[model samples]
Target: MRNFLVSSLILGSSLVALNTNAAGTDSTTFQVKITVNESCKFTNAQDVNFDAIDRSTGKQNTATGQLDITCTLGTPYKIALNGNGKMSNASNSGSTIAYNLFQDAQYSQAWDKSNTLANTGSGNSQALTVYAKLTGENNVEAGNYLDTVTATVTY
Candidate 1:
């Protein structure tokens, strides 16, 4: 009887150990990390130069400015554009100095309202994505092309 009991105890202990190890091995951990990395490469075809020219006036307006960004490879990014008239000595009136800013001439891609959510955000640097294919074309005009592009930011 003593011998049988001892053997049964050993077998039971061995079985419990095997089950515990198996369970532990099959168990897995799922983790997600949200870290935003911004790699910006802005390329504005219009090289703006604020030249205060001397004309018939004291304050000569010499602002032919443009802004663009080219950044293509990263996690999916969101894009957005700054408001118009942000450059005209911003004041209480909430207006712009430039004439055609924040107009339709600034966008390269126009996604549907639902589809556009991917490239829009409420943050600085405003999500300007770098497309892998378009970046290689080098088709960006050499001269001063007036456009107001929204930035893209991806994860």
Candidate 2:
């Protein structure tokens, strides 16, 4: 009976040791991360159309148009116009009408490739206005004059 009791006590002590070691824990750490890139695009662009002008009136013709742009937040961009600053006659290529594009209503700042409009993006669609004026000339041909202006956004 004494030997049996000692054996039982040793088994109980081994079980307790195993339970204590099982309760302890160890761990290692890892990382989570991401990367974002800058981007920009043109949402919309409207044509600038001037009202029919009667050359005999001898007055400058004016018009306004809009451009919409969307870009990543806090991105800096430049808007430029790529036109020759002249409207060629569709019927007669030799004849041309002189015109100019402005960034303001008062036609003070020129909006062209050389003179670009700089702005920052708000992560939403932004509307920009293009102001244009046709120089009044007494000898302009009596017909429909047209011009194509391309708007470019540089980030």
Candidate 3:
């Protein structure tokens, strides 16, 4: 009877060892990623104020204004201006004035959609100067005139 009991205990211990050795391990792998979208924005608000005008001069008067722009590094961009030269006076609905915007002080490159001035970003703020001139004789009238143009940045 003792021998049989010992033999049974040995068999149970061997079975437990076999089951422990039979157990296995496993692992899994996954992927990670991110997408960085390009972005840009105007850093400042600007207005091309052509102060008081002398309509009697019969000559073009000029004014200057600047805006700051910031964009992602290595981003290519162009600034375009769109507006009609005919500016209307608030007090006199019938009164209007003509003007033009340019990309240089010489008033050569018209800031029109067709021009599409091109530039690149260096991860820093850049100043863009807008030149404006009231061409031809200020033949509109002797009243205050105003015009607004939208400055668009394309990347």
Per-candidate Cα RMSD to the true structure, in Å, reads 14.0, 4.1, 4.8
Work out the TM-score per prediction. Answer: 0.23, 0.79, 0.73
State model 1's lDDT: 0.38
Put the candidates in lDDT order, highest first: 2, 3, 1
Q: After superposition, how far is residue 147 of candidate 3 from its true place, in Å?
A: 0.9
Candidate 3 yields a Cα-based lDDT of 0.82
Which candidate number has the best lDDT?
2
> What order do you get sorting by TM-score, best first?
2, 3, 1
Better of 2 and 3 by TM-score: 2
Better of 1 and 3 by lDDT: 3
Residue-wise C-alpha lDDT for candidate 2, range 49-93, written one tens digit per residue? 988777677778899999999988999999999897888888986
Each model's total of backbone clashes: 17, 0, 0
lDDT of 2 at 88: 82
Report the C-alpha lDDT of model 3 over 93-136, residue by residue, as the tens digit.
Answer: 67877788888888899887777667888789988898888875
Please give the range of 10 consecutive residues that has the lowest summed lDDT in model 2. 135-144
lDDT of 1 by residue, 20-131 (tens): 8888445678999886655545454353344432233334233333435444444344444432322332232332233222212333443322234243223333322222
